[model samples]
Target: MMILRLALAAVISAYAAAQPASTSSSLVTYIFGDSLTEVGNNNYLQYSLARADFPYYGIDFSGGKTTGRFTNGRTIGDIISTKLGIPSPPPYLSLSQNDDAYLSGINYASGGAGILNETGIYFIQRLTFDDQINCFKKTKEVIRAKIGDRAASKHVNDAMYFIGLGSNDYVNNFLQPFMADGQQYTHDEFVELLSSTLHNQLTTIYKLGARKGLR
Candidate 1:
């Protein structure tokens, strides 16, 4: 019986030793989209229309400080991070000081951002999808430099890429103008545009080595 117990202890030790060290480090999560994902960039935009800084915005979040997340509490990205075993990404604008921590994936989502280039109805600081993509590319480069090619590749390929958009394109471009100028595109035209834009964005991310993308 003693010999059997010793063998069991040996087996347990071997199994524990085989487990990888806990690195606290994890793959980077890149959240890209509109107000839904905008954690704080709007505060620097010099525009009040797209800002979400006030009571009741982050009422359900930790400390109840308005982090500029549009939702009443944690945004979808935050929920995804909790599921993926990593910290919620920081906003891109807040990374101006070259903090390597922010480079571990940043939120390029602007509050009034849209899929179309000319869709920011009344806001001058709104970002278009093209602009968001450009910022994403820049963030990728920074991640590559700081985390090395392999880690960066793993970070991107394995990381969760959350994209929440299209609603703004509909709100700011289609519905608003339809109400104002009575300008109407058939429903088909609107759907086609949205689909094509989404496809292009996903294709771009796939090319960037994104294997685990979400919408």
Candidate 2:
């Protein structure tokens, strides 16, 4: 999968690469990825060990309050949103009961997640890339309910998408001796699998109404 930083450079010309439509106040962003793009998704995963809730994790953020970002400050996602002049979207789980944040978009990234479903199994409760996409789909349904179908469709089609994945598939799965992928496939085969899966994943988002592909 394409890292969020790489996606940033490719999708936008400058101003931190999350360029909102010139006619709109702010472009809604649908974020998907691993820790590098995760804001606070993992913190709400009850069984998740991939959380970044510790104080040191947000020592550099506003008021020094940890918001589940893995970094000591804002993440690539946060920076992108700031550049676009909007609040960073909140975690997907955090939206289950909140409707006021829909216009801000939703973040489905999870720490330790990867393109492959099994990539972060050791994290015990991380959302794989597939899981994140599913959450986005559910998010779309909620958006439709909030607004009429036509407006919701337009909203989704006009939104920006950011995806960052794959690092964990290399660091947490393919490189781990005990992982099934490492035991069953050669390096070349593993890469092919990743590419193939990601292609389908991207297609799904497009079919669901996203005009741009981030990964």
Candidate 3:
């Protein structure tokens, strides 16, 4: 499964690489997902129950210090960005709005977050798909302020947006006997809800200026 996921991520990176040079250089990368794509957004959440800032989490990373990535080293997001010849965007929570790094887009994923806001409720704190998208909106505002509306619009449209989500909604929410979703709806109904919710969220991103996306 890990190998498969890496292969798919590579496809997106390759597509980005194949983009015309004029647009490629201006392309920023944004990531959203659960542990598989999470870098360090959860580390900055004061009360976040899902965290990876401890020993063994990043033993393979440089300096052997944990950076909130769930993997032993870099997450798929890190690998994809490095392949694209750009630094992986930093966690949105880790940067001040005025920081120059804000121009490079942001990673808004949380380790336990899911498409449905209630999916990770037991974790006490996780950024749902809604929360991550909201952060992106704020990110756009910051970029607009720095480069003006027209330029920012163009930059955002040129950016690469990646999302790895949904599995958790089933693994951690719908199938969890302790959760009400399982009791409230049949499996088919739940699946439909998940699909529609994801479609709507992706549409929201498209309307917000994201033109190239991979999931």
Q: What's the TM-score of every candidate structure?
A: 0.78, 0.91, 0.92
Worst 10 residues of 1 by lDDT: 1-10
Off by over 4 Å in 2: 1-4, 10-24
lDDT of 3 at 53: 93
Model 1 has an lDDT value of 0.71
Q: Tens digit of lDDT per residue, candidate 2, span 1-215?
A: 44546756445436444444673356678888899889888888898989999868999998898888999998888887777676788888887544768766888999999889998898899989999989888888888888879988998998988887788999999999999999999999999999999999999988889995455
Candidate 2 residue-wise lDDT at 37: 80
| lDDT of residue 160 for candidate 1 | 53
- TM-score of predicted structure 2: 0.91
Candidate 2, lDDT over the whole model = 0.83
Best by TM-score: 3
- Per-residue lDDT of model 3, residues 68-159, tens digit only: 99988998888888777678888989999789887876899898888899997888888899999999999999999999999999988988
lDDT of 1 by residue, 1-215 (tens): 23533453355345335535463245566777888678887787776478878988999998888888887899766765654556778888778545876546778788888777667657778666778787777777887887798887777776656676776776777778544322656768877877897789878878887786544
Ranking by lDDT: 3, 2, 1
What TM-score quantifies how close candidate 3 is to the native fold?
0.92
